[model samples]
Target: MALFFANGATFATWGIHIPTIRERFGLSDAALSLAMFAVAGGAILVMGRLGRQVARLGSARVSMLSGVLFALATGIILLMPSFAALLGLLVLFGIANAGFDVAMNAQAATVEAAHAHPIMSMLHGMFSLGGMAGAALGGWVLSLGVPPEMHVTAVALLTAATALLTRPLLLPDAIPIDNASTTDGQHRRMLLVLGTLAFLGLLGEGAMYDWSTIYMRDIAGAAAASASAGYAVFSGGMALARFGGDAMRKRLGAPRLLTWSAWLAFVGMLLAVALPRPWSALLGFGLMGVGAANMVPVFLVTAARLPGVAPAEAIANVARFAYVGMLLGPVIIGAVSHASNLRAGLGVIAISMGVIALCGARSIRPAPAEY
Candidate 1:
């Protein structure tokens, strides 16, 4: 959990600084989106191979090492002198961040399986908590006139220390060769459906993560320090909702939960675009946080348990799709915003959420009653 928290914090720190980074680079929205694509491109490239690495090396070892690498990469990104240099470094950042993310989630899934129960949502809740902390802290420091270099350095040190201390506490990977076998046709179809849902859910999430602060700054007319407040509030809402997600899932079931969440997200996005006031935008983002909190976790948990599919393979496939959405999200928004406006681009997100609401229920099949 500490590792998850650290990873989330590290990622959030980077996210909160994006507006500053954009200003430093003097990047237009399209140019910034292109740079952002490098981050996702790197993650997608590495995610395809991550399952094999986790299988060979074990999740515990990979998580620790990747945590270190993730911290190092975050620390170095702000030091890039030019736009081209930032783009290249962001790719490295993406690779390291993706490695850490996969290894940690793989560990979480292993832990959940050992207990024979649902705890994925709680584990993910810890991540949202970390994001909340990171965004709030980054905003506070930036408001105090701290440099991005100093902010990232402090985060790097903290995450590195957290990883070292928590490595010993993580569960070991125990996915067996039998359970890791290739999938059959029906299984493949199910995996694809689940992956598609995850892709859509995470597409919205990625947009919020990468662009919320910018949106707050540009569209909501927020001051520089307070730009991240909306993001912080968003993370807080996600954390609170995810902490309760397990109970909600038990009551609501995954399919129904996902369906409603998408509707919730659609309403939230509509509010943001319709009002465009700082307070209203923050409220909308918070509602978005609530709506999006459990979608990926539910998808990942469902994938991991799909009959005939290896847990690692299922996770990797779904994660790949999710990351693809995440990568394309900012670029898509950037392109739209460049051609039209930010509100129009965000309307695209609202439509995507509506599609998810309409289609999300089809992904989950009735589970067999078994031990």
Candidate 2:
């Protein structure tokens, strides 16, 4: 739990510094995109390797080391002498984050496997809370006239300390499952299906994060400060609903729950775009948040439980797909908006959810919730 919280907070702090980084380096939009690409590309490059390493060396050890590096990366960014060095550091940042993510989640999957009921949802809920808290605290710190460097350094040290302190608590590595009946082909097919759905699911999530506020401002005709409410409401809704997702998953099962979630997101996004009103848009985005709350968790949990596949390996494979979707989702929307209008771009979110609803429902294995 602490690791999850620290990871979220560390990532959130990096997000808080994005605008600052841009200004400090005098980067144009395209250059910034290149920087972002470096980060995403680095993560993708190492995810499979890190996943395998986590399986071999144990999640606890990898997670501890990754967490430390991940936290430090954010603090080190401001100290870089040039934009080129910063870009290189961002690549390392992505690698550390992906390592931490896969390792921690592999640990979570192991812990969840030991229990009779669900816990992954609640753990992810903590991440949402941590992100909200970290962002809010960062805003407050800026308001207080503290140096941005000081604030980031403080968060880095604290998070790194937390990671080190919690190292002893994470469960030991699980032995590899030896289900020879489950062929490599079966695992590949299952991972491919799960990866596709994860890609679609996270694409919507990334769209919401990047485009929701813009939609509120440009399409819904809101004031600049008021437009920030769009993302606030959406993330708030996600955090609140994730605590209940375990029950939802248990009662509805994966297929039905996923379908229901997709439908909710689809409808929510549709209403937001069609209405183009402030209150209505906020409400719709919030609904989409609730709908999207459990997507990655479900996909990852399913991937981890795949017979004869290492949990970390399966998770990394699926997560790589999801990461690509998230990385491109905003660009895709931006392109669509540039070609047409913001309304049409936002509509793509709805279209994405609609596709996920149709395909995600069928992709999930229909096994009982316990699996």
Candidate 3:
């Protein structure tokens, strides 16, 4: 849990410094997009292989090493000699971040197996709490006129220290499954199905994270103060929901939970797109958060438990598609909105959620595990 918190806090440091990095480098919007793409591209590049590496080396070791690298890469960006250097550092940062992500999740799966129950959602909730704290603290420091370099450096050191300090506590990773057998027909098909669900789930989540505020302000005609609340409420709902998601999964099971969650999301987003009122949009986004909260956790838990694949390897495979969806969702929404209107763009969210509900009769079936 502390590792999750450290990860979130370190990521928050990179996030809050985005505008500063832009101004410092004098980058055009196009250049900034390229830089952001570089980060995601590097993460994507590594997901396929990092899983094997984690399996070979153990998640505990990989988590510590990658966490340290991630923090250092994040801290050194402002210290880069040129724009090219910053871009290079960002790519490394992304790679390290992805490694940290897969390894830690692999660790979580190990812990969950030992407990013989569900805890993924609760661990994810800790990450959410950490993000909120980090963002608030970063915002405060920025408001007080702290230098980005200094701020990032301090957070980096703290995160690195935390990783080292907590290194002794992580559960040992699962034994590696034979790679050849995992690619057999059934496992491959299961991977594809899980990947699809992850793609759809994260597409909605990424869309909300990037566009909800704009939707609240532009379509709903909200005041500036109220507009930001759309994101705040959405994030809050997600954080809160994850804390409850374990119990929900225990009680409801994935198929029924997903069906109900999809319907909940469909209704919530429908309310927002149809009404176009500030408070209504806020309520809608909050519900969207609740609906989206458990999908990834359930999918990941299922992936790690797939019969023959190493838990780490399966997670990376699933996350690979998820990252792609998250990367494209905002762009897709933006293009659709450009062709039509913002409402139409957001309507994509509603339709996608509806698709999950409609098609889930077949696609969501998984091994009879307690995930």
Candidate 4:
């Protein structure tokens, strides 16, 4: 839940400030895209190693430390005097984000295992909820004429408080070593397939997060500040859906739920691309959120249950692949938009979700009987 709040706050920070950064740096659209890509690059370059570090140091310790870094990096980005310095700060934020992502998910998986219930989806939902609050707060702050430094500082303080509050709820290093041994031989192949599906799913998610507002403002003719509401609505719907997803998953099972989610996302993306009105486009984005809400959590659970790998190792491996998707999604969207229109570019994202819906079942095996 704390992680989710942090997720919300982080994106809210970025979404509300992106325009400010663009103005401050006198950045062209392409240049802004490249700077955003730099953040992804940092995450891609460091996530695998950071995952290993988390495994060695323990999720609780890593999460606490990463939270501090996350807060500090946000502060630096707000205070940096030059574009180059800001870019460097983003890199640090990216690294901290990567570590936070892996450690939190790893911790969640442990908690879920102990409870013998579906909790991962709800945890992610909390993140979406946090994101909504953060985005709203950011928009409010900007509207109230709060300076970037003060706004970001407020976010940093909130992040630190959440981290400390939730620190006690996270499990210690108590996961069974035997669980790691299950991913041997054929298990490795299964894990690879699950990881690939997760990668594709995450790519779609990243595109939505990084590009939805750009699409709205550029294609739908929304005002700069109003455009962010597209993501806010999408994220709000996702949070609500995720809060209910665990119960839904209990009724439908992971395989069926994922299949439906893919279809929903595909249809939602198509509508978003086809819709001409801003309101309709925002609704489409919301539908996409509903579709995507459960897929990642379901895949992460599958990864954790793979044979011959510890839950931590499995999460690390799969998370590395997911980061690739997250990194590529926005960059591809930006590149495509530079070459064509943003709408035409986002159409590819819809197609990718369609393909995932078509193939996701084949990519994941049923959870092991033991699980």
Best by TM-score: 3
Q: Candidate 1 on 271-292: residue-level lDDT in tens?
A: 9999998999999999999999
lDDT of each: 0.83, 0.86, 0.85, 0.79
List candidate 3 segments past 4 Å from native. 177-181
For model 1, give the RMSD to the true fold: 3.6
- The list of candidate 1 runs beyond 4 A from truth reads 17-32, 78-86, 139-151, 209-233, 270-283, 334-344, 366-371
The sequence of per-residue lDDT tens digits that candidate 4 reaches over residues 232-351 is 788777888898888877787777778888898888888888985688888889888898888889888887766556666677778778878887888788788889888878888788
Q: lDDT tens string, model 2, 77-137? A: 7889999899899999999999999988989988988877788888899899889889989
Q: Rank by lDDT, descending?
A: 2, 3, 1, 4
Model 3: per-residue Cα lDDT over 1-371, one tens digit each: 88888888888777778898899989999999888888888999888888788877888999999999988897787898788988888889889989988988989989988886689898888888888888999999989999888898899998899878888998777655455235678887888888988888888888887899999999999998778899898889889989998888888877777778888888899999999999889889999988888778888888888777888888898999888888888899999999999999999999988987776535656656464
Q: lDDT score, residue 247, model 3?
A: 84
Best model per lDDT: 2
Q: How many residue pairs clash (N, CA or C atoms closer than 3 angstroms) in each of the candidate models, in the order given? A: 0, 0, 0, 11
Which sections of candidate 4 miss by over 4 Å?
174-185, 210-232, 273-283, 333-344, 369-371
